[model samples]
Target: MNLLLLKLTLIPTIVALVTLAIRKWGGKIGGLIGSMPWVAGAILLFFILEQGKAFGIQSIQGSMTGIMALITFCLSYAIFARKFTWLPTLLIAYVLYTLTAVVFDYLRLNLMLSYVLVLSYVVLTLYLFPSPTAPPADGRRLPFDIPIRMGVATLFVLIITGLAHVLGPNWSGILTPFPILTSVLAIFSHTLQGSNAAIVTLRGLVMGLLGFTTFLYLQAHWLPEFSVATSFGMAVVINAFINVVVGKIW
Candidate 1:
């Protein structure tokens, strides 16, 4: 339990403080940290509050609710920072999920699948849907840094989660999706480095994804039908491989 809370809060909090002390901190750090554990703990607590227990691995319905709540709370914080825009976003997701949780007794499977389907939509939005209001990464040219950092973070979390899945069937069935990893990473990167486009962020994203793709292909079997040759081939396409070809083009 102590370890869980440390993983959940103290680490991020301390890292954030260190960045601040070192005069490296920039962008929306405070709001980022403020929203994290509060939101996650809220959703986890919500289930415990309503159901009297943690959402077990087998409870797809509960798991999905927690995921959706997380998604809603997360974006809501990052985007609005306590403003009008936040309310509509929160209300819509909350109302929709509320309907599912309350009025729709007949469509449990449908609700869970819908939330999972929304998962990709949210991620693609991370890449495709540019933020209306960005964190104040002042004087920083590396706008692409944070998102790439997020991609890297997601790759790491996915790799670890995949390992857990293989090692622990009982745990796998519980399916505690760390979908917010990318978001959290983006927030942290901005807080730490002042801009997400730090060369490190891009490098980390490309390397991490490539590493995970290899792990998935060689040992983990994440995409069962995807051949190893095909996987590495795509990784090569990220223009990162061009550095190998063009030699120091950046």
Candidate 2:
């Protein structure tokens, strides 16, 4: 019950912060902040407490797979956003993400291999990602936008964590980074701002995935040897460092 309350409070709060940050800072920095593992990290913490460290550690492979699919989702959405409205663009990109997730899961690559491949894929996808054609137009804000974002994010967390026992580690991990936040950001940006805004936001998200992927990768090794808090803390610092450097260069 306590955990449930935490999920209800924490996930929405983080989503609200990310949404407001994007509004204040624009898509790139906001997307970078969104890319952090707040949702996934919280979910992993719950898995560790409920399922055990092994369950959490084993789940990293699936999270890596999910990250790859997330990259595809971002890239595809950015590419399609130029030509279509939010609905068709989101659907097409979602299909691509599902297909990518399935293929990666079937291969069942080792952790290190999956890690390397995903990092490589991130770079390649960024290169292939559509360049922004124009700035987001001045679009009207909708009522209860933040509340809606919060509701969707909280619901996603509830579903994933509630089903942890049933999904087990691998499937849980795959679903961990399942593009819920990405979808919200993309759809909202597309609707409220414009396709260019959505594209920029996704590109920023792909860039931030550098740190996000590393955060998940380290957990595989760290979770077994260190306290959960310590492991997550160190991973976050490293994740921040990677994002700092990548943000400067990319």
Best by lDDT: 2
- The 10-residue segment of model 2 with minimum total lDDT is 131-140
The C-alpha stretches of model 1 lying farther than 4 A from their native spots are 1-55, 59-61, 75-106, 110-115, 127-250
Quote the positional error of residue 18 for candidate 1 in Å: 10
lDDT of each: 0.35, 0.90
Q: What is the Cα-based TM-score of model 2?
A: 0.98
Tell me the TM-score of each prediction against the true structure.
0.31, 0.98
Off-target runs (Cα >4 Å) in candidate 2 are none
Residue by residue across 61-105, what tens digits does model 2's lDDT show? Answer: 999999999999999999888889999999999999999999999
Our model 1 lands, by Cα RMSD against the true structure, at 12.6
Q: Write the per-residue lDDT of candidate 1 for residues 48-129, one digit (tens) a residue.
A: 2333332322333434433433443344333333243334534553454444333322344453354444444344433542
